[model samples]
Target: MSHRPKTAALIAYAEALLSPEGQRRVEAHLAGCEACRAELAAIEAYDALVEDVRSVEIPTIDFASMELPLAREAEAVSRQMIAQRQRRSARPWIAAGLVAAAAAAALWWSTRETEPQAPPRAEAPVEREAPAPVIAPEPARLTPVVTLAAGEVRRETADGEIPLELGAVLDEGARVGTGAASELHVRLADGTGFRLAASSALALARAREDEIRLELAQGSVGHAVAPLSNGAAFVVLAAGYSVEVTGTRFVVSALDGTVGVDLSEGAVRIRPPRGEPIELEAPARWRSSGGAEGGAPRPVSVRGLEAPRVAPTPVRLADARMIRWSVDGIEIETSGDVQLGLAPGEHPVRAWDARGRLHTALLPVGGAPVELSAGALQADAPRVRAGHLDEADLRPVLSRGMRQVQRCYELALRQGTGAVTGRARLRIEIGLTGGVQRAQVLGIPESSLTECITSYASRWTFPPPGGPLTVEQPLTLAPTQ
Candidate 1:
């Protein structure tokens, strides 16, 4: 069966049979094939369907009009013939002749009424397409009805959720609610599987080919969103709120009317419980909640934002002049030799010396104090990859440190070896996840040794911090031994 026979084809056959050529083919085939005979009979059952679609503007059909009366009529005629025969033998012959003529007339009248009629005018178009028309089929109708429990809407595309039998096909970047169910086998668009916790629900509103669907289904299941080679977006639904983010991060208490988003370092959008959606810079935080229908989000400040800092390069011995700091336009400044103690925050620092010379620098604020003095003021603590930085521009901070040991260790080992050393400038790139992007040894000596020192940072990772971009911890490095 290379091709299945279409009902349309059968309909066409019955139509063609009305033609001389169709009549010949049917007569030839029906003479021998019982299957063909059966099919013909079946097709005849709904003969009205083959006619013009327009004329079928059906009024209720009187089914009683179609009843068979052949048996009853035959029995009545037989009784009449028996009475005629008993009345007279001589007249019996005449009666028999009359009966034969009458029977012939009756048969002719019945067959005449059943003869096919000329098709109606309105049906010409349907007759034309009766040959064939293409129409794509819909999904096989699954039982035609779906029912879900309270807080239990299920959907293939995480957002358009509806309470279902927990068989929704969740795609990558989808979400479900908390407390929706404890067991669910959701297939993400990225082909990943997840089991929702009971009393939790979420949505995978975002889809990614290279990442885990950012599903926020109830009760934070923990996020392991697939990493985008370059970068991508993710979103999940919780309560009346929805979260959009790029790269991997974490969220806690996203059910019960409150949702927390700690973008452990990535771009994200937090739609609040009652207003507009806000774009979140990397290394930022957000919270959300539910309201009325798909409630709008209200912007709320991210908690634990490190205060902004001001640190300008001083000529080492030169008296530091005017120093000022501002993030959202809140400014802080100090003059000559005295440095302003700015709060910890990621901010651009500007300064001027007594010579009226002005300078600017980007300051990544952790919980530590940054001196406003000139050249690189080494931190008192062992900073992430902060071994021997020579470059004035490059900075890389480690948050999740255990992931890159070899890279961090080599920089430490090469510190004093002077084994072809310089300021040992190095770059440690980190995602919001604090994972290393590219580690390079810059402004330093070049060698397999130099490469070795630069390469030593191949093992650093950052733990969840206050922001998205990795806390760039500028460091110095050189080849050892």
Candidate 2:
């Protein structure tokens, strides 16, 4: 028996109104049966014709005679069937009844044509009420973009450290950092600008369309907030203090155990862990030395900082045994107090206490010596040092490196000789400065491309380590068309 689909099945398939299993059956039947295929095509054409007719506007329809043709056609077909039955059975009454019905239909049509026709009347204008006004919805907010990044800057993600570059997009919960001699600048989608000072870290706690919150982990950040909409909030948080502002230009710094809020322009409210919130206007400065101990904030001068001149100076310290000092990146030994001739300028000074806590300060020198006391130092968060790269640390680096290599391989696929598909091993040596000191490819064929890959890997930098270290990574590249 032929397994062709019926007309109804073909129409259902054409309209896509069949269930998945039914459609599959119809499709299978149609594939082998040319007759079913022809039927489906005809059904589709009929559907299209019906849709076209529905779209056309027929200005006038004569409902008075619309059903007359249908009735006449039905009667004619009935009469023909009755006449055929009468011929077989010799029924005279059926023939007479069919002839009478035919004569009545003909007389009705004749009278309908002879009757006088009336003139078509014009339709009255339609009274359409105005449509309701449509209100457009607000546009969606976009993620913030990095407008500028200078000096040494990097972003620490769950995966690994990614060097910050201009035009980088920062999402919420991103942690950004700048090195000792580096600085970073960023702008939000709303045109608010942030300047991050050296050796500083800032985490984007939240960045929404209506509100923005940033947490300063260490160092200072200067913000030039733009005008915001009503109910909008911009907040900066530190370990012991929070600064809330609607729109303002200010600086927030977390140094040692002290938190400082300096307002360059506009106004902001500084709320400490304890004590009344301190409100400051433009050109005002407030400093709190003791965190959580309820340190009173006092107004200070709004003086601009100048670059210090270089000169040999004497260094004074309190409790030298409890601190290890470094001047201009050089470790210095001080027994109580020492006199050393140094360049006159802003010097980067770092001290590590006996408890392994690191403190950073800037020493300005010209003619007189610099004095550093324990109370004036800014202590940073504690650091965890490991002898070698742990699995946790190594995983992100591998993942990030693999992504970089994949990008490079994709470029190679567009620009190079053949598809590179193999596994390559790299042994990299990292310096204490968090830079790749050396990179060597092992177990891979020596070629210019391999050297280029090594060169690319050598540019990868991580956070500075407590000591120099070496790590080996294996990379697998798949063939790209």
Candidate 3:
């Protein structure tokens, strides 16, 4: 049984002609050997086919010019000969070939009697089937939905921005933005959630299982990422760099041309537009210098951020019925004046007074807590005057100052940090007296560079509009390499 059984042995085994000892041995071999078993089954199938062929009745042949009695006699003789030949062969193999030949002859004779003769000059036509068409595969549909939403969260649609609610299924490539006092939490099918903070926005980009990527336009997003499988990734694109992770919890922000990351668990890799990738671990804070000239994100010391503060700071709220605040993505609600041991970073705080008016502010927490009065909180926000300038009056003034803007960028480059280049958005207000009222700049990380640009922009004068007119202009700086 080390090798395959011979052909004759196979035939003998199928016919039950082998001795009991031989039968036992072949059966044992077949039980273990698939190839040998297949061969044996095939032999059995052939024998069955031969028996079916022998059982077919041979029909009487009829000639157009011959008598019916003579045709009947010829058919009877053919059947007798076939049956006699079948009885003569005891071996199944020999019997198979003879039965097949006899069956073919019978079929040919029967077909001749039933078919009408074709014209001598005509030939049969051949038919062929067309080749199968090729079909392309469709892409995978990833359905990440809004699991939790608070305040004013909106998703961008064809019509415009619509309010985003819980359980709303988000489509791939959709852009979602949060209001000044809003929050949004999106969960993937795999149970990972990316919570967008107040005044933050991000595009879904790609949400496939293998890779999930988001483009952060502005504001902050806290990510509570689930453990990912091998070869899968989760990435956040902000400013000119990307923060990629496998499975971790962290917060990333892209505010005023700066990128920052605060990791509390797991690890992440930050890839900047320039320089090598930096590996950041848990219980650490990293931030890029938010200035016109973009700087690399480096490990920075935040007292309450990396770890808990040693002491709790007393926060006094006068005449407030309810108050609420959020740390990471978790929300906390309390009543009356309360002491909060908040970390020394920017945290959003909200309170409701006796009149039910909501007052919210981004509290810059220090080692000690500060008193927040209802009137003082209201007064902290600036008031904006109505704009009276139109595009026709503001376009030329900005065009003429392009060289001055370039000079400001050159001055920033000559400082300690080298090659400062990026796009900055400048917002200018023209007063009724035609002098620049107020100027603000965004997108450039360097404060000195922005100050220089804004300072020159404010000196530009325009024709009196009889009212305050505000105009926003975009500036780009590309230093000569």
TM-score per candidate: 0.22, 0.33, 0.36
Please give, for residues 1-481, the per-residue lDDT of candidate 2 as tens digits: 6565588777778778999999998898788898898888888888899999999998898764645566467646644543333232222222234345655344334333231221112221110121222323322233555543444578998898888865466766889998764556566644475777778999998776677889999998888787777667889999868999887788898988678887767899989999899888877777786334233332221111111122134454444544355665434333233223345567777767677677887877755656666676688776545435557765776678777766666766667642667887888887777678898877766655566667887888776665678888887767744
Off by over 4 Å in 3: 1-139, 290-329, 332-481
Candidate 1 Cα outliers beyond 4 Å, as residue runs: 1-198, 203-218, 228-232, 273-285, 289-481
Tens digit per residue, CA lDDT, model 3, 77-147: 65454333332222233333534566535533433332122111122111012122232332344556665
Worst lDDT window (10 residues) for model 2? 119-128
* Residue 347 error, candidate 3, Å: 26
- RMSD of each candidate relative to the true structure: 33.3, 36.0, 33.9
True-vs-predicted CA distance for residue 52, candidate 1, Å: 74
Candidate 1 lDDT over 173-208, as tens digits, reads: 344443322223233322122334345555554443
| Candidate 3 total steric clashes | 9
Query: Candidate 1: worst 10 consecutive residues by lDDT?
Result: 139-148
User: lDDT: which candidate is best?
Assistant: 3
